[model samples]
Target: MTIKKFQGRTESEASEKAKKELGENCVIMNVKEIKPKGFLSAFKSSTFEVTAAVEEKEKSFDPSTAFKNMPKAKSVNVVANEKIEIPSFNTSPVKDRVITPAEPKADSAISMFSRTKEKEEKELEQKISNLQSRIDDEIIKKEIEAEDKAEEQKSSENRQPTKLKRKNENFEFIKTLYEVLIENEVDEKYVNQIMDEMEKVNWGGNNVDTILSAVYQKMILKFGQPKGIDISKKPSIVFFIGPTGVGKTTTIAKIASKYKIEKGKKVAFLAADTYRIAAAEQLRTYANILDSPMKIVYSPEELNGAIDEVKGYDLVLVDTAGLSHKNETQRADVKNLIDSVDEKYNKAVYLVISATTKYKDLLEITDTYKEISDYNLVFTKLDETSCYGNLLNIKLHTGAALSYVTTGQNVPDDIEVFDTQKIVKQLLGGR
Candidate 1:
């Protein structure tokens, strides 16, 4: 008997293959559906695995006159070419009987049956040994073939490059740029927009550097320009709101220090962040260093009083408690505090975001924040990461302009006013 496995798109195809190899008499043992593995297999359909077997046919057994025509054993002596009359044994206990020479055949055929059975056993053993050897050889051959196929598959996979490797130079540039944007945590939709724009350009060139510059220019055109602080009143109220640990307080301090020391404009600190321990003290410490007065407001009414205290000052930088976007009550409270401010003071709200945040989370946070307060974006922790695609992503997503970007922890020196050319340089991996 021999067994083999065959696979094809359909059961009929697999059965045909099995029959071609194992003859029409092969028996179908098992059938199963199987899917291939690997990158390309994702697009391929499943196949059927069919196990079939074939066996050598054996002769039918006969009982009556089984050894009547059996050949005489070589050990038996023939007398004058006469047929030899083999002796037969009687197993009955009544009387022991033996066949005489006159009897051509034995009525009790025990001895004759014993000799014939022994010869049949020897022939069956030889056939079984040959079948076992053939089965072993087939198994070894299949194993070797499997090993060779594995090696070939590994080699083919290793040699595979990007699917776009053979595309035109312009396409290569666009693909590389798309990867860079995605690596920088840019939103997929915005990345697609960039790609679509890149595809529209009529320019032709293979130089990667040139293509990078072209992409940078296109981004700049899309990002547009940054908006400056709106200090149109005596005390322009600028509120900084964002998720916890995004450095909202620090960013407010930076802007405050810049206005007070460098620009010589009167600036006061107002913090409504009573949730965290020593939240007010943190701002007080910075205020003390700059010889500026700091005020802590616990409620909306107190926030109104704080705004009145800073009415004579040129600028009022307000820092609210960092709340998770998931906390709806706290976010609404922050929005109420901003609403309580006097309408006389020109208001400018800035949503402080961390540059290191993932694009998906940023989108969620911004979406939630947009429902509470409309504001321009202020990005912090630029020094901590290299991915700036989020900057353009947020800009395009919210239709808001960027105001300030903080590079490091320094109070006055680390903050930079948003500039288009500078941003283009940063986006292109420049210093």
Candidate 2:
């Protein structure tokens, strides 16, 4: 893997630089705002610094060739070592036996009868000999088969360690990776999915780098690409909604700052979070700082009116009251506010969540909002937690596009477009 860093006036620019230099396959491993340093730094804007990585391609290893040069076991020949002997029958007695002429006719008849009996006995003896020979042949065949089997077993025993060693190595590496993911709080279900997917890959060897690269790529693909605010078309209204104390207000401020200050887009703020006086004031303060218009509306009708006021603006970010997911009334209020938006306006909803939230609560929170609207996800307080499994968990569960993530309380500076590569690397225990 090759890792390097690039800087630009914006994150996308820096990312593009990385991709251009490292090839399009390069992934952004980390992203940070590099604040201008020195005495006159306040006059200069901060630039984005991104760490990017790309796997170095190498010749593929063929597993079939691992034992291609092994010595072959010699063939066994059982019949070459043993000799067989056959017993000969004496026929002199029959030839030498004389027929007496005591009574010419009677002696001749008696001799004929004796000769017939001798012939019958000889035939019976010949049959026994043939049967014995057949038995010996069968015995030799069985002995030969047994020897061949023994040789094959010995050869297998000799080769077993090499095969077993490779298997054990692969198993150990996978186990370690599994443990690392679990330790980082990745859900067992997702861990199993990742490992199962790995099993399907035709990785030629158990090299740590190869396996890690495969897993990293799988996770990146799982995360897909993150979609942030779209300003390609003017007059876009974005609504921020989530549970209480999830930093929704602060997140809105960060995004508003990015657009108004960095991108120079005409930004407006619509504060529907009338339940909390401080939330409204917080947004107002940000609006004042950004020199953008701010409005406070208590009803869906008022929100639509506020939207109309910002029709000429490039972007309007709406902040909704954070309420318990269990409260159906509050949920309905949010749903109504979103539904009240005029179909003529292009609107988007964002579900802001705290990274430190428990996985179970995250699930419940995401499930609740899912009933209200099809919104994108924006995670906050990422600096407070080391385990980012919930990020992946919620993303997978909600199947929502991840937008921005806030790392601290610093407006604009603490927030950035969700870097899937960074989160995936952290999940895999990378720095």
Best by lDDT: 2
Clashing pairs in 2: none
Off by over 4 Å in 2: 1-160, 202-206
RMSD of each: 24.3, 39.2
Residue 31 of model 1, lDDT score: 91
Give the backbone clash total of model 1.
0
What overall lDDT, based on C-alpha atoms, would model 1 receive against the true structure?
A: 0.77
Best by TM-score: 2
Q: What is the lDDT of residue 222 in candidate 1?
A: 77
lDDT of 2 by residue, 1-431 (tens): 65667899999999999999889999999999999754446799999998887776643344343234222323211121111111112322211122232333645644454455556656776887787677767867988999999999999998888777776787788898899889888899999999999987744345667888999999998887899988766689999999998999899888888888888899999999888899899899999998999999899988778888889999999999999999999999999999999898888999999999999999999998999999999999999999988888888888999999999998879998999989998998888
Per-residue error for 227 in candidate 1, Å, reads: 2.0
Model 2, residue 395: distance off in Å is 1.1
lDDT tens digits, residue span 1-431, model 1? 55567888999999999999779999999898998644346689989988887774543444333344333666453332222344222222221232333453554353454445556766776787777677767877988999999999888776553323423666766676677677776777878877677656543423556667777888888787788687667888889999998888888888888888888998888989888758788888889988888888889888777888778988888889999999989989998988888777788889999999988899899999899888899999999988888898889888888989999998878898887788767666577
